[model samples]
Target: MTTTVIAGKYVLGMREGRQALLQDHYVYVDGTRIEAVTRDAPAAGQAVIRYEQGLVMPGFVNLHAHCLRGGLFRGIPDDLEMDPWVPKLVYHILLPLTGIAAKELTPGELHAVTALGMIDLLRGGTTTLVDMWHHGQEMFFDVAKEVGLRTVGAPFIMSASNSRLGEDGNPVWDYGNDGLAQLAKSVALFKARDEGHAGLAQVAIGPHATDTCLPELLRECRRAADDLGCLLTTHFAQTPQELALLRSRYGMSASEYARDTGLLGRNVILAHAGCSTDEDLKVLADTGTHVANCAFGFAREGQNFPYARFARAGVSTGIGTDSHGMDLIGELRVTGLLSKQFFHQAHTGTAHELMRAAT
Candidate 1:
């Protein structure tokens, strides 16, 4: 394998079990694997990419994302003040409209759109991205392989709620989808496309959300993920309405609902626990489930998902750009600022902590 040496003015590396920012460092790569990060000079004649004034660090792993959706609705500012008590846009604006766009565009056209999202991800310094999309959209994987970007494609498994905004402007849905059938399709896509990239690609079981999926569906997805030895992800506590709906239907918060549904575990990534209660955080921490905080998306709607809230709860927290933007680096600033404000402490979200969350 070819050895490429990247010399950066500033680099993030490990030291004494903590993140350390190293200066004038050389990062050596042997093809796909990182060989080392040091100031040592590489062997003579090695291909060296020297950055005189640059920050070189680990490529980010975005824990939750919707690349195509983010790209399609890139700069539309959602300035409408959101009622914190409502499950605002996923049903009314985001999902239904994206579904229409996905169905209307030709497969090739959709692939181009997907490519556009990936390009944004690459430009934003994301090496690995965990993205969930509607079922049967296997071409998303095709784009990942073509670009050589590490990817976790979570094809959605939803029990059809036939979600829509009611005449009175409230979100409406019912338990009507066959999630197992969709799981089969995701598995098939995994088998067909997730190999041959030296494990750079994977397929995670993505249940859309608690409101859109039945509890039985979530339970079965956990079982399938276990049997297949893959990752599983879903939206949890995205809005106050979802929490109220779950409480009314299941007598539990989304975190409690996850525990009951067998969806809380290390291999699981639950997105947007922004609306979670203190008790919910306790449940999440106790279960060792990781939370993917996509704060920028909620921030646009006047909601802030403070990273400190989850991190302080002892929940393993990571950063994701979600549908607002694919720039993980930019999202870090927003996440840190929100975290500080949420905790009312300037030291709550240190630079190291924020960078650690991104990686």
Candidate 2:
């Protein structure tokens, strides 16, 4: 087998544990692994693809996302008005609508939507992403394989996956929201699809959100992730309602609940953290829990996801596109500008650090 050499004008290579932009570099690829990144030419017979104006770099990793939903609501909710009862855009609009789509759309319709979403990810240069959706994750798996994007399918295990709007315009959740049961289904999906796949797809333990899941269920999710040796991810500190709920029920913040349940760790990737307090940031920093910051979606809902705060707090931070606008480049560019503006610091969310977080 001959090696495929990507010789480019500029390559964003690595040096001394930091990003180094190397000019006139040749990156040798032996199958999937990058064999070398150097200025010297490869010895003898090899396939060479030279690009005089190309800038080669590692593909972006969207740390938290809902690809299908992003496709579904792409152009619809840009200027949506928020109802009084439905204060949270994601809970009231995104997830509920996506769930409805899952039940209403035919399998073929679902396939097309999922494929479009995955294709969008590829077009955006996202070679890998963590897709978190509630139902019909098998459609997600199939689309990931077909499109060839490395996916970590995190089936959302909500303690109350089912809910309905009451007459008073409040969510009336059924009591059948079993977190352990939902988790088992996710694990089964892991064993079935992600077990022997050729590294293109894997699974993660996702317990929806702290407010949506009970304490016992969150604890079980940690154990399940540990037992399976997979990553654990969930929504954290996204809304004021969520924070209030956690504080009311457990008398602890979302970060503290996560820490108490043993879910706060290096293997954990918590999405959002928009409403996190200083103590919560401290918990995130001390536990080494990674934060998947998706500021684009938050901006659409008239909220700023202070990524600079998380970065300054020494929390491990990564980027995600979240529900709509799956363009990760736009995610970084827009989020960086928003961060600098919101935090009143030009140095906040620098291009170098933002690119690093995305990767």
lDDT of each: 0.83, 0.83
Instruction: Report the C-alpha lDDT of model 2 over 1-359, residue by residue, as the tens digit.
Output: 56789988999989898999999999988887899999998778766898889888999999999888877888777888884325446656666788889889898988898888888889888999898987455878877888888999899887777754456443445678766778889888888877433588888999877766777888899999999888999988887766776787779877778888877999899999888898899989998999999998878778888678799899999999888877898899988998899888899899999988888
TM-score, model 1 to reference: 0.93
> Tens digits of per-residue lDDT for model 1 on 21-57?
8999899899879999988988887778998898898
lDDT of 1 at 303: 78
Candidate 1: pairs in clash:
159-177, 160-177
Whole-model lDDT, model 1: 0.83
Q: After superposition, how far is residue 227 of candidate 2 from its true place, in Å?
A: 0.9
* Model 1: residues with Cα > 4 Å off, grouped in runs: 166-176, 196-198
